[model samples]
Target chain A: MIIKRTKSHIAEIFCNVLCVFVITVVSVNAQKLNDDFFSPKSRLSFGNYLFLEKDYLRASNEYKEFLKTDNNDTVRFKLSESFLRIGRYEEAANNFKSLFFSTSLTDEARLGLFKSLFFEKNFVRFRQYRLEENYTTEKFSHDIDRLNYISYFFDSEPLPDSSRLFSAFADLNRADIKKFYYMKKNPDTKNPVTAALLSAAIPGLGKIYTGEIGDGITSLITTGLLVFLSANNFRHDHNFRGWLFAGFAALAYGGNIYGSAASAQIYNAGVKFNFDNEVKLFFEKHNYFLPEFDFVNR
Target chain B: MKKLFYKYFLLIEIFVVSSLFPQDRLSIQFDYANKLFQTSQYFDAITEYKRLLFFDEAKKYSYKAYFQIGKCYKAGAKFDEAIKYFSTASINAANENEKLSVYFEIVRTNISRRTTSRALQILDEIEKENTNTFIRDSINYWRGWTYIFADDWKNAADAFSKIKSDHELKKLCEQVEKEKVSVTFTKAISYFLPGAGEVYSGNILSGSITFGWNLLFGYLTINSFAEERIFDGMVIGSLGWLRFYRGNIQSAEESAKQKNIAIANKILKYLQYEYKGAKP
Candidate 1:
């Protein structure tokens, strides 16, 4: 009787365990099957995953979907950032503009808005915006100043004084900025009229003055040879040939004069291009004085 | 005994469920990636493919994922990354056909990158594998394309000729060859007469200028010599007449070469955009 009782109790316990196991398994399966992957939580996680992968377009879509039901500032910032990453500057600016009033992200959003404007290459608008009363931030003021100074290099806007602009840059970069400032103020320009006059006085002298040694030498040789031919023909009584050679010499002389003036213009343009390129490269190498944002850290 | 039996049954059920779950998830992920690829969202497709690669414990989709990643990179014009991924796919390929397909992709990418020598080397390797006639013909066809990218029309023509007697590309190549000005002929003609080669090569204004300069200088040199002015004749002949005469010949040759290149490039541009035929 004791053995049967023990066996019955054990069997009852086993049956109960089996029932719980089946229920648990069925509930878990049902939950998984019915799960909505497009929920806010799921979209946020998936969107974060895509963002980390640099799939900005899809990530922005996911963020947009999540933002429909949720209004998290960080997510909005991320959505705006995704737009920035994919070069949708106008949309990014608008999105970032909405966050300019947020307490926690106000500064970051302002910086982001500035970045969008800067990247659009509308320096005039950027300068105009920077001059607005509330557009400046105390925390990022130095960075904003640096960007403002950098803008002067790319446009015809007058640069600020050294003390104001160079204060935002590193000690090493201060020298470079000063050089750029001087170049902007008094550009190393070649005078086209002077170049033309030199070439008129002596064939190829203007090209030589403009640092085109090879072209100058070639011009001198060609002009001298034609003149010599004309003189020789005249001395030898070949009047028609002498006249033709003289005409050729005149053409060469006039062309050399025009070419010299053009060379001076080209030289001045090259100087400007080189300086602009250097300024651009320096700023790019330093990330334009902007701090690196770790959006995922918090 | 009853408790042990219940434990064993539950354990088996859990095992079956767990085993089936991952397989279903894997298929879903694979389908998601395929959908991304089909929609021409190559950048997003690459991300999905990479996700599949990370979670795929069975290595079931490794080769396919790598191949698709390569295609995405190729679409983005990132040839170096595309080549690297295609090489990985070739190594992981399950069969000879898959391997050959990857190799062909590498060749195509190389051709697009203008690395004609590398493309040709791979084509040679494929040729040595003793592929069937159709495959051989395909190889020759791509070889012709590689030559075209290299701007070697004669070799391109030869490669296409081996595919068939009168291939369309071969005919195009022949047409380009016929339309091209002969650089050597222009040089030879200019050597005999200072400006005749320029006129023959259809540079009438340049030819007239060259002829006028040469005639004036030549007359000066001859007139100086007739008047027994040795120094004047020598200076005029050597500096003015000889320089322009030699310059005319060099210019004519250079013009002919440029004209040939221009003709070839016209056909090449047409082939690149408008040709309704096989291409690399």
Candidate 2:
């Protein structure tokens, strides 16, 4: 009896595998199973739906599973785009790289790589990769050039030529772009050393120079009042009171000097913050001047 | 012997083919996704569930897939997305029963998200739609939980009382409400007497130090002016007495706030880890 049951069990396992495989194989005869939910074609279809819905994280996973069996340029590009959308810049760059050399999507892939690098703040590497002769895409060269110029406005040194930068953008955007360029060229920032020296000589002049006018006036009045009090006590022959007032005035003067230097540092930080926010707002609103591409909608 | 062989072979083929039918295959897929959910592989489970939804053209699985996806997101503590998916699931619900379940899921997520007003609003809407004993109980239970998360323990106790006067959560809420410090009283007393609010909130050492400093500075400034040292009096009063007095009031207020926070946190911790009930 045991031997007979073992033989039946082996036969059952073989039958199950064969049946599952037959069901999955969608030949003309097996039309009913063509809509199998786990099939690669269905997965790709579902992935497109998710990608269109902006559900990029799940969309990327679906694309990965579908790509395991099928090789399509649009799907690969979308997979890269999904990664980029979800801030997975490294993975996005790698996927875009696969479409670089000979595929019809070389131009799109190159632009995608540049965007990923730029968003990741890898400016040096982005420049190196963009300027590589073989890697440049002729179709998107202007877009890439504008992106490079924008990166300079963001934080890069030795900024691009002002006129060239202006010509790269449209007429409507030129005024805003020029504002960013000139702000980068000659930032309205204060020097901490100059502020400190000014304060040391005139109590609160450095704070006024750094745009803290109200605080500067208060500091000046307090120090000046203490000095006047010290002179009054000495003229009235109150030696101990005179020295106490003198001590207070000296302490206030020293504090104002240190405070003025610190104020200049804070003023510079504000300048940088405003510049960065404006540049970021402009680029984000304009999509960094990158062209629109939506595979799902198409 | 040949007849017996054909009979067994036919039985085996029938068993395999029956399980391979499209409907049964979708069931297999659902089970696979559910297994991932049960194992705490939430992200993977959502992907599989989305796949099921996409290919189940009949949409028979839409409600279940969306519902389970919401649960997975909830387990991951992503309350916003969990609520979104649960709301979607409610739209797909086939009947009032399924719709109510998804609605409660959303309310529970709102409670977890600490948006108590939204939770209460949803619960009230559910209450208006449902009057069955079991569902009423469920609604009141969640309403009570919303109050608990909102730190309105008095209302929590009242809501739970509607379910059962002696409910364990109701008693816990009552105890918490009774033990919490009164912020208004603490602030009032501090205005009347320096650092008294700190003492009321159980900060005896800080209260005593604040009182001592204020007393010393007060005496110094009074004496300086009495001795006709106007400059000395002005400086001492502005720089010493006023500073300590203002600091005392602020410190007293902070102490009261911190004491109440500690009380709330202890109960919240109990509800999170120790209480044997459905929580936010």
Candidate 3:
């Protein structure tokens, strides 16, 4: 009886242990599997790895995946950045536009948009911002202050008096002012078209009027030779030769007229260009007259 | 009952072996694809990566395989197809860095294709999605390169200047800006004076050649008349003088064009081969 009882006790304990093992195994099997493993951090990290390897397309996809689980602003910013890296300005602009109103990056986006416009050479729109659009001025005051001088030529409209043109001279000290006044008074004297035409009609007359004696003499000699050749050809009874001489005479006459006109135009343009440069140099030498934007002071 | 349990155990073991075998096959396929990619055999690499899908237990590597396939297509200059695979990888990748890499690759491929508008969009997305400074700086640097390729030198300069330690690229941008000749101004100069365009473009040799030709022809034309040989003068002046005079002007225009081409080549040569700055 004792042996049977001991055997029964051992059997019961073994059965209990076995049951517990089976139950544990079945419960573990019934538990949810992590088979649908999708880790955003891992994807983003691997994406960065590929990006560092210069595999941009793959990196872009990985970032996009990360976005599905994580809709963070920083990620969006990076996405737009990658687009711009590849020269997708239009799309990049769109992405940036969303951030344009955000306080943290609004200024950056605006500047970036401006840069994009500048690259496109859409000067018309660029002008519209300072003149027509009248967007908030406080955000870009420093940049505007720096760029205002260029706006004079960059814009289609007339320039404001408070900017460089007048202020540059007004702000000059005594010695600088004296130089500026002299430069203004002695404006360049260019040859007049009527003068050139009058001189051209009389061979050396155009060059003389334009104050170029050597050039006038050369023109007179050239015209006189051609005229003599036509006359001689006609006298020698060479009809074809006379006609050819006449053609040469015609060319000389036409060339003189054209050259004289061109010289006058060039002289005038040069005068204007020089005058502008003089004023610009005077101001540039004097620290541009106004004040620097004073970012440090601000 | 014991016999039945033995049979069940055997079946599980067989299942595990089969799964392991497929995994091994997938690993081999991945290795082969990577080798092809390393050798720049992009098309073949894409094929090998695609072949991994037929294996039973390759789901874990599916994301990497898709992304690699995109890279292969990108390397092959098939930007559109690369974009597709990259998009798929973005959806499939489990690692954030991997997803970012795919996005960046798409952007880069677009740049290589000169699709600037699209590339910019990708950059905007990256800026929005990323907070890492290194990645940001790198993207900005490449954006500069994209602008350079688009011939927007000022913008390229601006973009390059924004990056830290990007001095070389900044200098390159400045050089490009300095070398750029205004097309309109060049043409106008040529129209005003026969060889002036070439002279302005710093082609002194070609410009002097044109100037000399015109001067010589003009001198001969006038000298003939001064000698009083009317018939000989007329024939020589009309035929020889006129031909060379016109020829001089045409030659000036042609040389100006050649000089412009040379200037373009100078910039293109540096950009294409010798540039040490960031490039596609």
Candidate 4:
């Protein structure tokens, strides 16, 4: 009787194992069916709705889900475009690259990838990628020419044509003109350390170089007044008073030199900020100078 | 059996209800105190904080609450009450650092209220505690100012000079010492010479007035001699010159001495042992 009871327990364990295996297989298959029934197009449509609602983060997730099963080139292009629209340029670049080997849209994809890198200001890779690819599209051809001039501003390449740069400056906002000048002149001007040292030697010279005439003149005058006071106090035999004035004179002179260097840094930051904004604005107004994906069908 | 099961279920229900309710009375009182504090009703906030200490189960915030009550009283210029609450915080605070901080507050509040003696007592306790050297130095720095408020010029000079060799407080102390003059001595000197007290106290206006009065009296005495009415001139000159000369000297001394006292009082009022903001 005890042997019969042990045999039944073993049989029951085997039956339970079989049942668990069957359930696991059925659940896996059901999940696959569910995924297929939902369809990538439906997910893309929902993603587009979310995108229109201005939920970029959620829309990016939904588009990524659709792209997993939908390898159609047109859908792929839209996925890249969606990422770019939502400011997810890194993901957009990866998606755009999937079309780089396709003969039909290779030119468009390369240009789209270039734009993604440009927006992110990854200049090194953007320059390298452009060098590796050869494009036939008229649009990309024109962009390549513009890129050449822009590259000169960033890299230590020789300054682009002065007349062309000036004409571009004239068309830009009045505030941007100073930035354009900074970008144009920075590469060729005297080193900031040299300028600051020169200014320290003469209280107002660095401020003049930084285009701050008022501050330069004020620093010079203040320093001069303190020096004069110290000298006069010394001549009058007021040793303590003379030393106090002399100490103040020295402080003023040191502070002015430090301030001139700081001013130069401020000027440099302003130049970069203005130049970046102008470049971004110019491209944004021109639809990023790239192709659109209108080939995707319902 | 049914009765025992029902009793157990009833106990479980009560436990669940009590847990869910979270002793709303304590929370409501704490919230009210916080609201009062935010609204700048510092006096009302203090009352609420005291109420919470009486009724609230959580004692974690009690020390901070008491300290804040002290701060409120200090802000309102109720120095005695502020010092009392700050002392309570010092006694009841959980951590050594917290106790030290409370001790600092007590010293600060006493300084604000111009209660230098109380502040010095707290400072003494802090020093005995052997706390941070930096805190010790800061306390002594303010202790010098406390002496200045007490009008103890020599002690103030001594306290300031202790740290005078290296720190900014030394310079401030030196300036104070230079500006100080003995109140009685100023008045007494003016009695001997018109405007002498005013000049001693650095009062250009009152000193000039005294000088003019004495000069006018001297001129009248000289004119009497020039007119050749010797006997009449002698009596007139003696009466006018002596009375006016004495009065000029007395007025100069009084004004100069009053000016010095007024300056001292201004400094005391500002650094009152009861002030709430960061001390200089």
Most TM-score-accurate candidate: 2
Clash pairs detected, candidate 1: none
Model 1's CAPRI class is incorrect
lDDT of 4 at A170: 28
DockQ of candidates 1 onward, in order?
Answer: 0.13, 0.29, 0.04, 0.02
- Residues B87-120, candidate 2, lDDT per residue (tens digit)? 8999999999899989989999999889999999
**Pairs of residues clashing in candidate 2:** none
lDDT of candidate 2 over A1-298, digit per residue (tens) = 8998888777767666765655455243255565477678888888899998899998898899899999999999999999998999999999999999878798999999999999998899999998798679899999999888888986648887788879999999888888778888899999999998999989899999999999889989999999999999999999999999999999999999899989999998999999999889888988888899865354
Interface CA RMSD of each prediction in angstroms: 4.8, 7.9, 8.3, 22.5
Among all windows of 10 consecutive residues in model 2 chain B, the one with the lowest summed lDDT is B11-20
Model 3 spans with C-alpha error above 4 angstroms:
A1-298, B1-18, B56-58, B128-132, B188-192, B209-279
**Which of 2 and 3 is ahead in TM-score?**
2
| Candidate 4: segments with Cα more than 4 A from true spot | A1-38, A52-54, A102-104, A133-139, A144-148, A151-202, A293-298, B1-280
Q: How close is candidate 4 to the true structure, as a TM-score?
A: 0.39
TM-score of candidate 2 to 2 decimals = 0.83
Best by DockQ: 2
Per residue, candidate 4 scores C-alpha lDDT tens digits across B1-280 of: 3544564555455444544443554566678888998888986676567656644456756787888888888878898988888888878789888988888887777777778897888777778877676776666777776776676655766665665455454554455556667667876787677778778877778688777777777787787788876776687667877776677666655665576677666555654465453472
Every model's TM-score on chain B? 0.85, 0.91, 0.69, 0.65
Give a tens-digit lDDT track for model 1, residues A1-298. Answer: 9999898788778777876776678668656644435568767877888888787888898899899998988998999889988999999989998888845788888888888888877787788888886777777867777787787788887777778777878897788888888988899889999999999999999999999999999999999999999999999999999999999999999999999999999999999899888888988988887888887433
In model 1, which regions exceed 4 Å deviation?
A1-62, A197-205, A214-257, A296-298, B1-19, B35-59, B72-81, B91-98, B112-114, B123-280
